[model samples]
Target: MDDFDDDSFNDVLGSMEMPTSPKKPKVQPSTIQPVPAATSTANSSNNTSASITVAKPASNPHSVLVHSKQRGNPILKSIQNVPLEFRDDIVPDYVVGRTSCILFLSLKYHNLNPDYICQRLKALGKMYELRVLLVQVDTPEPHNALKSLTRISLLADLTMMLAWNAEEAGKIIETYKQFEKRPPDLIMERVESNPHQKLVAALTNIKPVNKTDAVTLLQTFGNLGNVITASEERLSQVMGLGPRKAKRLFKTLQEPFLNK
Candidate 1:
């Protein structure tokens, strides 16, 4: 019986298949796609073409605008408003760099009005530039008048004086001619022999001093004649007098006598 049982078990074991192990899940291999090639040459060429277009300069707008405006406006329109004589006066006698001198004179008178002097100056202006100094002397005389002429002549490139008559003017011209050998100082001295003319000449040279001040100072001191005689101390007491001014007055006073 044992033999039969053992043989039956062995036959069953042999007939049954051995227990199989669990199978691993199958893994499929991954596929990689290929990358596209770079377009570097095409990109570089496009950038170079763009840079060239940006480098060129544009035309100037301001210059074009100015030309357009000038074409629209005519220069003659502005010139038409000026008078013919005035335009002629603006024109120069010579070329741009040339030089010339113009002079003017104003005669003083105690009895005569400024209107007469102004009228004379205006007439004289036809030839030269005339400036009026002043009018009216406390004491009018030929010497003072001549002095005035001489003084102005020294200061100006040219001189002109108001003459009571043509004969008086001729006499002055003759006198000046005689003293022409001497310089201005000697001429002034000779001219001062006439007190009235001396006063005129002194006043004309001492122009930095006002006419009103000259008249007032002379009046306060006495007159031009006596003012010349007064000491510096006496002249210094006047309202505007200072040391320098007092000295100038004293010198002017002595000029006539010294020149004589």
Candidate 2:
């Protein structure tokens, strides 16, 4: 449901890359139930609604889920780092992470019809916490197309990614999948220079402590040394240091010297 137009969203056949021998993945046949003819009686009229059912897809562990439409795309085959499984029901080109999806777009195809992205975005509005618009610069001049998508991405809360070729996009998609369950501490700076900086870093590491509370501790007690010797009552006297945080700070600061 794109905001730009009222025309119903019909699935546009996706063929970003050239056909690769036209081999299709086998899918279980979908079944549909016929609607019963409407019946009219003197008291009331009734109509039966039809129902449809499709087989559920089998999930793989530590794997990326791909859309069947992207079967022939080079990105589908290039994701060699992690396993991938194809499913037709997904909206995005690649389901890279549990909470993330990627929509691959080619600039050359949409150069004449730029609003096509608007329709795609409308279909993908805020579905995932991390949405990536993986755009391929497939045209001689892609500046105008990128400009439009960039503006829309801001409004749609999408992370716009630029890749010169399919290989790079594949790598980016694979990276998202691999890092999905990983924590950011690997990339976080655990050490900082300067007492002022270290003070904040150290205190903030405690569950209930933060920069403001850390600064309050430093201001109330001269330094880390004084803080360590101070009683829990004195520690709790600092602004914002409630009984819990203050007791936690005192316990942490006075952790046995052998353990330290």
Candidate 3:
């Protein structure tokens, strides 16, 4: 029922492979940037001053903040265009946006110590709204590691990103930073108008078909799936469809979803 061909793909390799993730920096939370100034106003009636304080969010909109521990990481050198600043106070590897952060691990290292990611995830503990457990697959077979990471992602509410190599991994990080402020419509599925109209429009787009014929097929078959599964002979039975047109529609529907 699915189209996955796992045998066709292999894990990626690189000269920058590290056997273990960098150790967590020994820094205090107080190292974060100073708090934003508060507004103080005097209430003349009460003869008392009141102050309103709003906590400043830790994320930077312009540049991605990286942990100092990742100074030697090859991924950092691949990230282009976006500015990167190093810090030691943050827990995650790369702070890409306001609520997003990445924790990187390589399969080479995960294989050495299977439970390492689990301990890291436990310490991470739902800190960022968007926590990415980015894994670089450096081994020949990565399915077992991917499976474990996938399960961990589900349990820890962390998003999992699998990178074939360090260059691709760096590009992924760069993309997250560059598009962090862009609207989601760039990648979202574009919906045009209502469902019924959209379906009719789609069918009419095929060669030798029209709006009236499209609507007729829908009415006759009850739904899109049923219409697609209907036989060419049954389609010819419809009021407007001829043998040639019905055959075309049936053949088109049966075509492979992909060109290859």
Candidate 4:
């Protein structure tokens, strides 16, 4: 009986399913929350609007930038409004006094050499006040009348005549009479009293040759003494002399030697 019982138990155990451990509860992982598309777009729009507002100009009109380089100097700014004649009248008094010398050269009919006039005036002490006035003589005749007019004009501190017109003689006389109150020293007075002395006096009024030109001319002739002795022909070849000037120079050179 015991053996049968044992066998029956074994058969019963074999027939039954083996006991298994209980299954664990199913578990879920924690989920991350996703942002809303509308909220994200709204934040982006707000940032863009804020940037645009900041870029706008400030309220103050005076805040505008001014370029200093574009501005003009206040002192010189109004100069353009002044007239030329008025401005010229404002020349310094000292300059007028220094340049007060005048030269009146009459070129009515005959052609006068400006170079010769300059040289002659330089010989005179009044060269600084030398001025040239040119007059045209349309008619001939009435020679003595014109001569008288010329004589009167020559009475000025320093005056010279190259050509005279008969018709213009009256005009010259009228002009002289107008300035008669303060008549210039008569150059002719010296001319008549002592012709040779007058020639030297004329030289006193001459504008001196520039130092460089004088030195150069002197050097070319070997010395001032040599230059004085040199013939016009020789002088003509020395840089600044021309044919007309050569003749004048010839006259000048011969004058002193002849007088001596």
Q: Pick the candidate with the highest lDDT.
A: 3
Ranking by lDDT: 3, 2, 1, 4
TM-score of 4: 0.21
Off by over 4 Å in 1: 1-201, 256-260
lDDT of each: 0.33, 0.64, 0.66, 0.32
Q: Which candidate is the best by TM-score?
A: 3
For model 1, state the Cα shift of residue 176 in Å.
35
Local accuracy of candidate 1 as per-residue lDDT tens digits, 121-217: 2222222222222211223444544453444333332344443432443333333323334565753545457664555556656635565657667
Q: How close is each model in CA RMSD to the real structure?
A: 49.7, 16.3, 16.4, 51.3
Number of the candidate with higher TM-score, 3 or 4: 3
Clashing pairs in 3: none
Count of clashing pairs, candidate 2: 0
- Which residue segments of model 2 deviate by more than 4 Å? 1-58, 190-260
**lDDT per residue, candidate 2, 1-260, as tens digits?**
11222232222212112112332322353654321110010111122122222223437767787756566677655789889887765555677765677877766655645556655554443345677888877777777667767766766667999888878878888988888888889779676778798877878888789889988888887788888888999888888888999888888877875953
* Model 3 misplaced stretches (Cα beyond 4 Å): 1-60, 192-201, 204-245, 248-260
lDDT of 3 at 219: 91
lDDT tens readout by residue for model 4, 23-126: 12112222322111111011111111110000112123112111122122121222232211111111110011111212222332112221222222222222
